[model samples]
Target chain A: MVAPDYLQVLVLAAVAIALIIVTIEVVARIVRPHAPNPNKYETYECGERTIGSTGVKIGVQYYLYALVFIIFDVEAVMLFPWAVSFKEFDGVLGLGTIIFAEVFMFVGILLIGLVYAWKRGVLEWQEM
Target chain B: MVDLMNWAGIYDTIEGFLSGLGLSFIIPLTLYAIAALILFGFVAALVLVTTYLERKILSDIQVRLGPMETGGRRFHGILQPVADGIKLLQKEDIMPKNRDKLPYYLAPLVVFVPVFVIMGLIPLGFIPLDIASLNKNLLVAADLDIGILAILALAVIPTLGAVMAGWSSRNKFTTLAMLRSVAQGISYEIPFVLAALAVVLAAGSMNLSEIVKAQSGLWFIFLMPIGFIVFFMAALAEIHRIPFDVDEAENELVSGVIVEYSGMRFAFFYLAAYAELFIAAALITILFLGGWAGPVLPGVMWFFIKCFVIIYVIIWMRGTLPRVRIDQMLAVGWKVMLPLALLNLLITSSILML
Candidate 1:
């Protein structure tokens, strides 16, 4: 299937920008009050005033979870569209089986990180 | 209907076919640039309309008029997003005190741009790719072997914005919110990937159109509901919609990572935030709900409808649910959703093998 022409995309984009800009303008006028306060801006937590800035120290372990996640989350995203075409070029291109093995092993290699996180007790709920 | 998708690789064919008609050097580059701009603009329009639809539906679900008063006519809230755009334009683009200026301004565009880039890869209903007089059966865009990688590449940029926005705010609550976004982004992204990988394994291809085509007779949901559910839920969290919008919990971390932004920058953050909601919904429609597949309607119409329904559900969720605690959010990902997604994938693979 051939794609749409550039002019069409421009028309579509113009519609998008116009729609977005207009909508935001209206919503702002509708929702945002004419005046606000310092108290309103101060971090609202529960009914009471905030204690200790809500920015207390965090553990290094959380960082570990994130590190492992960054490596895999992005990788998983790369895997989806490939999965979409798995069987199409099955014989001629060998796109299907190759993608599976590559990603399976990718996940396999990354599972080690999960195990490490487990060993480090990132998955555990108990407090030390 | 004029199709922007024709811009995908159409220029190459155009130049090829039209070379007989005229001489051209700068034509291809100009055409590509124009196409990209259209693509961005189209996605921006989609995000805005989706945002309006989200609010409207959510308001209806809760028994309220969403933006009816905006146009000052009943049901004319249709133009609410348009109006909002004009407001953002006129509003001051305020920079926070003690904030890094470069990435600070760039963050919203960084967050917003990639959503459209991903949109490109999804075959938006097979438009005929009328090349240099050869009729070939294929999609409208570049069918790269690594199409999915482009999506991932784009997906990675938004989190950078989230973290950057938090850090640049230089406020304590903003910092905590930023850290929470890191945790949220990381946690949800895992199950999402795992479940998506499961789908890839089952479908055996990485191309989204191929995935949709494979499900022609039977959508993957019947064979892989658990994976579908997990993927949908994790995607929700990844996009930070309700039930998983802990990153922006008002009762806890203020507006989370984006507490400091105001005026258009704030609007940018807000739009970027809702952009995720719209993106996740579209993804679900494309991936699981069967991209543009239905009996009566045109493919694009079906795709758009399915996408809208998912968007409706996400907005409905926002109105109904209470924010989960950060710890509980993590636990659900690891304990509940992750395990279920993992088991679903394993069972799916085993069944396929059998």
Candidate 2:
């Protein structure tokens, strides 16, 4: 559970970050010189006329990798609460095997997903 | 003895001071606002120092004098970062003609805001003050029960900025960089949190302060060395620093997601990187190096000393190590680091069980 005061702290910190960025920008706007050339704002290409829009379709591999990652990522979060409370339950219930086995099962299944990712070469960084 | 380490006692001191002159009409929120501003200044100062240090350190490595002209050659360019800040501010806030302007503008803010939130959750060691006759007051902004998780949840928000900056730029490099960075961040996060979870298991609580307190006997680094390494590496990756900085591969991506930004917008991303580096160092100090736990010196000084050592190591890595390829980073994170983290957890739980 989060302390309510933390919310106030969070708000204050967020506002401060915004203020600092803005303050710096405002200060720079006052003191710095700015000159814009027609070519200066052009998207940089290595000394060649920019060709083709950047909106071209990218490989599906990035999305697929992200999808696999999210599944495993959520599983990691789920393990945290259990990890923190494991000692308490072990002390109270004295059923160490039950809790241990259950978590092992969960993690073991996840590890299999990881292995599958490896075996299928999903984790590999290859050009599509 | 009363606990000066709590936030409530500190608040009472502020309230008493506010009411002392019969100006008690100020709301409690205003006090928090003041604390928040102080923390902001602290983070800003850290970013400034770290940036200068990185430059100087890198220069030293390459046998060059970094920032010798700024703030006078006598001071060896100590004021160079300030000058650079001013220079960055004065530069044009460039927007590409084909850009999605809103996300383009918002990305930096999104990236920048989370640094402060993460800082607030970290305990930098307690300091005593006369107002409440405080004994053991925590230096952190909030001692939330979900302490580290709260930071983790907030920490995840910055990646959205990377994604936004990447997609909105409409540049092939920025978009590609964004995808790689986001993927790297996401993949690395599992190991990062799991390594942290190993600490949680050992400490038996998720509160950052409690974890620090638990380390009073023996530092977790001595107890869980593997967790330390995994966390350190994952954190390095999470911040997109050197070795793990493939997402912003300068040669391949030309500054990657931030390629299109200029002026203050670029500065925001740059500042965020430094701020995260500090937070990562602070987190490591708290979890492994016995935060504020030492002989003779005050907790705050010990905390800073320990944190700086870690920061120095991080900087050394930046200066020395070559950047890993994007695929190699993901592979190590998921394949090597993740498994090691889980094994550490297993080993930790078993030790605690006995």
Candidate 3:
């Protein structure tokens, strides 16, 4: 109950932050100068007028990094509960060794995935 | 209800004072407002101090006077941040032509709110004057069961804001910067989480206050030096501090994802960056340097002292180290930091088993 109540406080904190940002923006809007020119709205490319469409193709290497990130992110999440309860396992008879081995195996497989990604050049951000 | 009040010392006092006036019904709402105000003020003050210190320290490092004209030459420009903030508030809010509309307007808010929420989760040590004789961590807004996890989870969110800013701006530089930011952010987060996980394994608790309490004898930094280094490096990268700020490489990306933002919206990103810096420093203190644990000084003082020291190191790196290329940044994150963190976790867990 206390934890949930504290969570409510967390939500309240978030709401407060949003409100503060909005308040600042609204005040700024009222007080700040506004002299909008078409030239000022031009896309900034080191003060050079941007040539052609601003819609550019990003390298696919970014997607590869994201894909690899997800796999390891899930591994990290799975390890969280095990890491928190790791000491508790030590108190029981042989549970420590069993869980340790299981985690090792689980993480070992992920490490292999990481290595595979490295070998396949997924980790390398090749210049496109 | 009584138990809840007892845990929050100041909240209890305020509630009691209200109830004495037959106003118990409004206590919860009043406390919530007060808590929110306190947190906001704390974060705002932190940003101001850190920003000023950063300029002063960087100037010292580079052998120059920083901000002497703004506050006063005698006081060394202490009021410069306040002046800068007011100036920023009065700047024209620029809206780009042909923008995506929604994400552009929402990007700064998305970037700022998560970082602000993270400050609430950080345990800033107990109330030194324990008026109620209750040994509760009254400083942290939410002492969640998954405190560390929650912090880490919240840490990864600002990248979405960067991406939104980049893509929605209809600027090529921002789009490219957004791609690099996402890749870099996600890559460094692994090692950061793993390094924190190593500490969790040692402390056997995800709650940050519990982690600090577990370190009463010896700090985890000594027990697992690799974890500390990895965490610190990954954190530097995660927060986009220099030597790892490729996404914001001003020469290349023209301010990167925030290239298009102006005025108050721009200030949101600026505030968020400083706030993330504070949170990262606080996390380092809590995870490695032993949060709020020190001699002579009070726990709150010790906590802040440790945080500022880490912040000093971060700013020093910013002044000294050259930014790495995006390719090199990703390579270091994936190839080097991740394996080191996993090794730290394996060693810590194995040692615990023994």
Model 2, residue A14: distance off in Å is: 4.1
Of 2 and 3, the candidate ranking higher by TM-score: 3
Per-residue lDDT of model 2, residues B1-354, tens digit only? 113323346667766788887777654555667677777778878888988988888889888887898888788989988988878877876777778988987888888887777777788887744456454477777777888888877888889999999999888889888888888888888888888988988887899989998888889998989999999999998999899888898899898799988887888888888899998999999889988888888889999899888988998888899998887788888789989998998888888778
lDDT of 2 by residue, A1-128 (tens): 43555666666666766685666567767766677777777776665667788777767767767888788778878988887788788888786667877988999998998888889988787786
Over the true interface residues, superposed, what is the Cα RMSD of model 2?
2.1
Q: What DockQ does each candidate score versus the true complex, computed on alpha carbons?
A: 0.20, 0.58, 0.67
The C-alpha local distance difference test score for the whole of candidate 3 amounts to 0.86
The most accurate candidate by TM-score is: 3
lDDT of 2: 0.81
Candidate 1 per-residue C-alpha lDDT over B260-287 given as tens digits, one digit per residue, 9 for 90 to 100: 6766667666766666666677667766
lDDT per prediction?
0.66, 0.81, 0.86
Q: Return whichever of 1 and 2 wins on DockQ.
A: 2
Highest lDDT: which candidate? 3
Chain A vs. native, model 1, TM-score: 0.54
- Cα deviation of B334 in candidate 1 (Å)? 1.8
